[model samples]
Each structure stands twice: as C-alpha cells, then as structure tokens.
Target: MSDALRDRCEELRAVVLELTTTTIEAMGKPSKLADVVTVIGKLRAIGDKGAAGIDNPDYLAWDRVYDASLQKMEDAARRGDAQEAWRAFADQETGVNLIARACTGYPGW
Candidate 1:
C-alpha cells in the first residue's frame, strides 16, 4: 500500500476502535446517545472518503460491508433502537477488521 492509503487505513482503524469502545461504554446510558451518533457519523465519513480510488477487489468488498453496516447503524439510531444499533456496530467492527487485514496483511480479530 502507498503511504497515503496505509495512513487512511490506520485512521479508519482508529475510528473503528474508538467507536466500538464508546458504544460499549455507553450501553444503556441514554445520555450518551448524541455522542454515539456523532461517532457513527464520523465513521461513515471516513468510510466514504476512503472508498474512492481503490482498485483492490478484497478491500473494496470489505469496504462495501463496512458501508452497509454503517447504514444499518444509522437506521437503528434513527429509530431509537440502541440494541439494534449495537448489533450493527458489531457487524461494522467485523468489516473494519477485514478491511485492516486486506490493507495491511494483519491477522483479523
């Protein structure tokens, strides 16, 4: 991977980690809803920005998975369904792991 692509992958990984941590920490806490939404939005933005200019099929596939998960999370958030949101976030976390593996040859969790 080029340095820029590697950097973007790292950035996405960090956002995914932070999102996962925050979601777990905020579980059952209504006061943290806004924060979770913000993080989700940030993750989506990162995914959107990084999705362009990738010619690798594996990475592209994983990226699509990530985007789909984000959409599910967003829909759940809009419906005020925290449990579903959490599930979607978990799915997204998997996608993030796959993306990391595809981009950096790291063993996925």
Candidate 2:
C-alpha cells in the first residue's frame, strides 16, 4: 500500500484502540457523553474513508465484527447500561487485528 493509505489505516487503528480503551474504562464507571460522542465520531470518520485496502476475507470479517459491535453498542445505550455499552465498544476493537491482517495483502496501488 502507498504510504498515505498505510498512514490512514494506522490512524484508523489508533482510533479504534482509543475507542476500545475508553469504552472499557467507562464500564460501570461514570462517563462523559462528550467522550462517547467523540469516539463515535472518529469511528464514523474512519468508516467513511472506505475499505480501500480491505479486500480480503479477514477485512470482511472485521467489517462484520465492526457492524455487530455498533449494533450492540446502540442496544446498550438504549438500555442505559453504561458498563455494557463500554464493554461492547471495547470488544469491537478486536476487529482491528483482522483489518490489519487484511491490509497485508493490499496491492498498495
């Protein structure tokens, strides 16, 4: 992959990690809505960039996991369960590993 795409992917990974960390930390603990909003914003931004290097099944798996995580997070939010919400979000970050793996086969065009 080109350096720019690699950089973007790295940025996405960092955002996912941060989101997961924050979510885990917020579990059963007080959390600021602003923080959650910011994380969600970051997630949306990264997703909007498109799955440029995500052509492999691994990447597809990551996407599926990500989509599932989002659903769980929304459900938790609806239930007003802060801990569940955080935990689900944190778990979602695991998909980043799949994303990275998929990127390894990118054409880097």
Candidate 3:
C-alpha cells in the first residue's frame, strides 16, 4: 500500500480509539445515559470499513466482543454499581483494540 493509504487507515484507527475512549469516559457517571446504541452503530460502520481495508474476517470476533462487553455493562448496572459498570465498560476497550488489531493483521493476539 502507498504511504498515503496507510496514513489514512491510521487516521481511521485513531478516530475509533478516540470514540471508544469518549464512550468509556461518558459512562463514568451513575446515570449518564450514554447512547451506547449510537456508539455501537458508529463502531459497526468503522468495522465495515476496516474489514475492507484488512481483507480479513471481522464480524464474528467483533460481535463476540461487543456482546460480551454489553452484557458485562448490563450486569453491572443491574447490580447498582456505577463504578463497576464504568470499569467494565473501560475494560472492554481492550476487546475493541483486539478486534481492530486483528482486522489489521497485527502479528499477535
């Protein structure tokens, strides 16, 4: 790939990372009411573009991570532990990165 194309991909990755961090930060409050669906929608769009860029399977792994993360967040909410919910949400960012890296064919998982 050309340097320009590689740069564009890096920029997209940065945007995704920023958005993910913002989502996690927004969830810090007890009743923040973060629009998780919207965030997820954006992520899905990114995932689609990323899949094309990487030419690798992404949907299955991405769905697994996304579902598990949401479930963890829901469980925390049900338990009435805002901090735990935020922590879980933040932790899930790791999964997001994993998926992103895998999409780009990062050497190791």
Candidate 4:
C-alpha cells in the first residue's frame, strides 16, 4: 500500500470514530446537533469514495459493515433516535476494528 492509502485508512478511522463522539456529545445539547450533522456528512463523503486500491475481500466486508452503520446512523440522526444511534455506533466500532485488523494483512500493514 502507498503512504497515501495508509494515511487514508487512518483518516477514515478517525472520522468514523469522531461520529460516535459527536453523536454522544450532541445528545442533550441542541447546539451540538450541528456538529453531529457535519461529522455525518464528512463520514458519508469519505465512505462514498470507497477504498480505491485496496483489493482485499476482508476490507470490502468491513466496508459493507461500515456503510450499513453509516446508513443506520444517518437515519437515526434524521429521526433523533438516540437508541438507534447507540446501536449503530456499536456496529461502527466493530466495523472499524475489523477494518484495522484487515489492514494487517496488507503490504505495509
């Protein structure tokens, strides 16, 4: 993998986890809702780009999991569903962990 790819992986991980943090912090504060929306948008943009060069099936599997989590999160945010947000975050956390672990099988990983 290129340094760029490695960096992208790290960036994706940070942004995904940031969503969880943003949602948690936004729970009671109406002001933080904007931040949550921003993070979700950022995450969606990153995810929609897909993993360009990575050819691993494991990575793709993780991506699918992450995408589903993102969809769930997006819907939950729209409805202001905190419970579903929590569940989605759990799924995302697992997906992120799987993604990181999957990276270990690659060249520089």
- The numbered model that scores best in TM-score is 1
lDDT of 2 by residue, 1-106 (tens): 4565566566666676676666655564545434555676677666666666545565556665675666666567556576777666545354345555655644
Candidate 1 lDDT score at position 86? 81
What is the C-alpha local distance difference test score of each model?
A: 0.67, 0.60, 0.51, 0.65
- lDDT for predicted candidate 4 compared with the true structure: 0.65
Model 2 gets an lDDT of 0.60
Lowest lDDT 10-mer window, candidate 2? 100-109
Give one digit per residue, the lDDT tens place, for model 3 in 17-79: 654565565557444434444454555555444333333334345544666665565566565
Clashing pairs in 3: none
Best by lDDT: 1
Ranking by TM-score: 1, 4, 2, 3
TM-scores, all candidates, are: 0.70, 0.60, 0.42, 0.66
For residue 20, what is the lDDT in candidate 1? 75
User: Candidate 3 lDDT (Cα, whole model)?
Assistant: 0.51
Q: Which ten residues in a row have the lowest lDDT in candidate 4?
A: 91-100
lDDT of 4 by residue, 1-109 (tens): 5564565666666775677677777676545656766787787777677767766665667666666766776677677776666566666354445565655644443
* Candidate 3: residue 68 lDDT (0-100): 62
